[model samples]
Target: MTSPLLTRHGAVAGLGPDAGVPWHYGDPTAEQRALEQGRAVADQSHLGVVTVTGPDRLTWLDSLCTQQVAGLAPGESAELMILSPQGRIEHVAGLVDDGATAWLLTESAPALATFLDRMRFMLRVEVHDATEDWAAIGEAVSRPAADGEPVTWVDPWPGVTAGGTSYAADPTALATTVRPWRLVLVPRASLGAEIEARLESGWTLAGTWATEALRIAAHRPRAAFDVDDHSLPHELDWLRTAVHLHKGCYRGQETVAKVHNVGRPPRRLTMLHLDGSGHSLPEPGATVLGRDDAEVGRVTSVARHHELGPIALAILKRSVDPSTELTVPTDGGPVAAAQELIVNADGFSADRPPKPGPTMKGLLMGKGCAADGGDLPG
Candidate 1:
């Protein structure tokens, strides 16, 4: 269940889903600094691990999710999503293939495994919830694999991978891209001993609070914190990594194509610079209000960065003006917030052309072109 290290010096347990792990050590600021400097390792054992085996694994996965993985090379890391028929994200995972097995590091392991198993029809694929056998450790920089050459999933966030498009107006300018992060799967049985060894070797032990602060600063989104039932990749600007516009048919391809070509996401993700003068931070799900105190959005993730003071990621209606100063209702009162655009106000990919006139089938069949402003990018 939980990391043995949770009992060690200065450890404080996390809340909700993070209850099984450490929230922080005594000095959260120092822990955050150490993590950023790469002198610390975070125990993320609470994350789930799933395994898929058999010859048809890659191709089968390619047919199901949002990313193109049929040709995924061994050790090459990827981020993928399983979307509903309406193109709403249902599950998200960090994937890495080890030639013989596809290891998925996910926040929703049992549900993901169950869905994949139901889709396996006559295919040779086998899905297993390997959480009992494996656990994850977080690192800021990629490290050499230990003795087993454990599957490591390098995060490809904020990068426009092949066949994917970016919604961020300035993808290269994102602060998130510079901070490299990855998850290393380790044998669960020896996890505590392994962490102890790293500590003995001079690595400082940080916790979720440290890691989360860096994430908020970088504008990185986690499914657990960021996603809602109605979330779309476009809203979160997830198209930069998760969705492949040119990939073969998948469950939600129609909706995805329609949105990118003819529609805009109803909402957009925004980073809020909050007034840190207050003693406490607004909790997740706190209502975000615009001019006249109108409800405009909901706060998704909140953190106090070592340098940035108080910051949060919120999903706001696309119609909300990016220049508008907002407020979040906290126990003390309302805290003022300034918006830092994460997804463009227009809520579409940067490179996508003007709206097309043709039906979904016509666009898929390559019918309409110049009428939509220009040919769609491959």
Candidate 2:
């Protein structure tokens, strides 16, 4: 499944899920600058595509996902998550509907499609893994489809959609974080040609390195990097786009409701500004240590930004103070880090209702990830 675009001069293959795609095309810093300036296109053909059709597609999805999708309009896009019964995130996708078909762009398409297929007992929905037929490309903004009419899923990150609330310590962060992201679907067969055309038109080609850098800087979460068996929406600040507060009962609605209404997430997502004086960057799953030299969290993703130098996203125990300076063990030694809070220690809705009786707060704070399964993906 290696991308044909990888044939481009200077293309270097990525690893893991990003395998078969370009990690960078010689110069990542310049590529990142072009991408942020909206003059670059990044290859994202490794992403999975799932198509759901039939008259009941929207309602069936709405009943199962965290987002309210039943009334999704023709060109509207939204993010959704499928959670385990305990409210742990299992799958996440960007959803968009054409007049007749619903397209899901995800990192876990096979699993998502299989889950959707099994859920269709008597429902009229038909789910198909269209990953082989379609490929995706990332852009700073939506562009005209080449070859045919392509579906685009616009990212709604860092935005509080209707029935959603924020847990960010700085409310202005949501208003100020600007990532005009879009994923455009194209015929898989023509992807190389399409990119060549864009290149001819003066658009620089970026890679996963640039995209990951931008995503980390924006405090955005990716399923392949951020999620684990115990990942809760509140922990990642994902409720802003993925969960509908007032949606009808979905698989994990009860836990979702309880956490936001009366309890806080045991773990919080944070941004780490790493010491850039050294050449070493911490790898994903690197241990994050507090001043006491004790493990407090794990780095989920890491990237060296064009301007921000070394930065990473980590999930820490909610008790970790925002002012605490931390360190991450890397191959080149320990790198000093400073925390920028993505989700606060009080990882609950700002508009949570006052409730009486014992809350789940004590239970969650005491157990942490061990209560859900010892380890949450770093």
Candidate 3:
């Protein structure tokens, strides 16, 4: 009933963050509190922020990433993804420009570095693992950035202060009252001091779970659970923003054009309302089933939302049917499942992250591990 990798203030991290909170790797309480009261902060020092500089930076990055980066006017940020030759996502990052350099922020894990190396083939670009140099934080507000800038993080379930107000004369003044700003901090050693400073400065720090659920609910895709080499960029609904259809060719360009113009992927990411009955709610990787225990999908995350009871982010194949009443096999028995999706007023499906990896079976399936009381590797 606890997340093995999550932490609350890093206190019970390796020790577990207690039972009430759901750990997707961070303190679920932080997230829960954030959703309930509109605020919380997370320990994002574990993510790497790669800075790309030089005159050739824009052209080099434009040729490598799926997002358009040639005209970034410093002080602008965009979520981006780098795809593999096969059209799978190699690395997905928040691409922010400070008017001088480009910053690619991703999980501190080596996967993104591996991606950067593969992407630096013939380009005159430099990629540095600034993980030890910066940290990131997100805040949701009831209004738009007071200075007139686009909110970097979009509220998935509504209630965002959305509007273009890039009117701030300075960065500090801009961030102070911004509607939704994912502030990135630098230097791993500076994370604690930075967070403390935010708290002292009266910034609302929501719990990690609340943040995760809000992003999931908002249909906003993010790292860890979202990017993998097998899934295409379009699958996560990053078409115009992350994946520019008119952009120059990148590693996955050929297949991307082919798929977008020709095929529809078999599965789609969805949100679900869970009954949370038998046993504790299933964590990520549990399989969802239709009638007769038919395989339909797998959950990416599950959190007890302050308002929505138990909710989940899942990937279900199209044949599974969005409205079908289903059950998901879990540690205990089966928990009831119902499919849901987020659609904006513009009729565009909001961003939703699919499972990072493809897995047809449970983590310990047929390994005799679970039966032997073995812990599963996520």
Candidate 4:
């Protein structure tokens, strides 16, 4: 899965599963700046690509995911979540229909294909793992698309789409407003040349860290980092784009409706401005503590931005006050964090109080009885 550009650029490769990709070409800060300024390209070929063929593709996928895709138009972008029967997120993908096939961009392609294969029972759709055949290249919209590249999925983060809602109380903090992003799929063989050409044109090659930092700043929740086996769409503010509240029935629809209508999500997603004076970052799974030193949540993602020093995304108890100063347990003991609300503290429910029942005295008066029956005789 390693890209040819990795060696050409003398990248300081990451270890283990990230062996093939560059953690940074040389300067991570400069790379991040390039990305923020729209002068960089990120090799996202590590991501998985799946393609669904046949006429029933859209309808079949729509029935299995949270988003409505049956009527998707060519080149239009949408994201969906495959939830378990209990309404927990199991899989998520960015989708685009090319008039003939439905392309899916996911973090785990083989697993998605396997899951879809199990559901194909007599369906006309054919799911193929195109990971080996394709590569994903990402850059900000300010970096124009490569000419003749036919398919690109523009990110819809921090934006309120139709049938969606925004949970962010402050619009200025949204990332997309600062720099829009897009992911383009290219043939694996051509990926190297494409990257080289961009490099030749003076564009810097950024690593995944740069993109992740920007994503965290935007309050964007990613499936790989933010989701667990029991993550609900409401908890991550994914209802803003990934879930269509009025969409036709699908797996986990009941749980989605129940949580959004009458009940509040047990946890809420929040952005934390970490106190970076410690010069240490809290690793994922670091316990987040309330003012009372009670474990309220865990940090899901953390990053140091070129401007924002250090930041993190955490899922805290819905009752945790947004104004409360919290702390995250780090190797250096603990780090102070200030909360910037992502999901509302009230948990986004619209339930109302029950109507008051008629008082006994009013009922008796309406029945022509005073204070009590036969009160006049008494």
Local accuracy of candidate 1 as per-residue lDDT tens digits, 145-178: 4446777888887677888887775566684445
Off by over 4 Å in 1: 143-148, 175-177, 357-378
- Relative to the true structure, candidate 1 reaches a TM of 0.92
**TM-score between candidate 4 and the true structure:** 0.88
- Please report the candidate that would top lDDT against the real structure: 2
Alpha-carbon TM-score of each model against the true structure: 0.92, 0.93, 0.72, 0.88
Q: What is the lDDT of residue 244 in candidate 3?
A: 66
TM-score of 3: 0.72
Overall lDDT per candidate, in order of appearance: 0.85, 0.88, 0.55, 0.80
Number of clashes in model 2? 1
Across 314-369, the per-residue lDDT of candidate 4 in tens digits comes to 99887788899999988887899999888878665322223224553243223322
How much is 41 displaced in model 4, in angstroms?
Answer: 0.4
Instruction: Tell me the TM-score of model 2.
Output: 0.93
Query: Which residue pairs does candidate 4 place in steric collision?
Result: none
Evaluate residue 128 in candidate 1 and report its C-alpha lDDT on the 0 to 100 scale: 99
Model 2 stretches astray by more than 4 angstroms: 142-148, 357-378
- In candidate 3, what are the lDDT values of residues 74-102, reduced to their tens digit? 65556566776767776767676655577
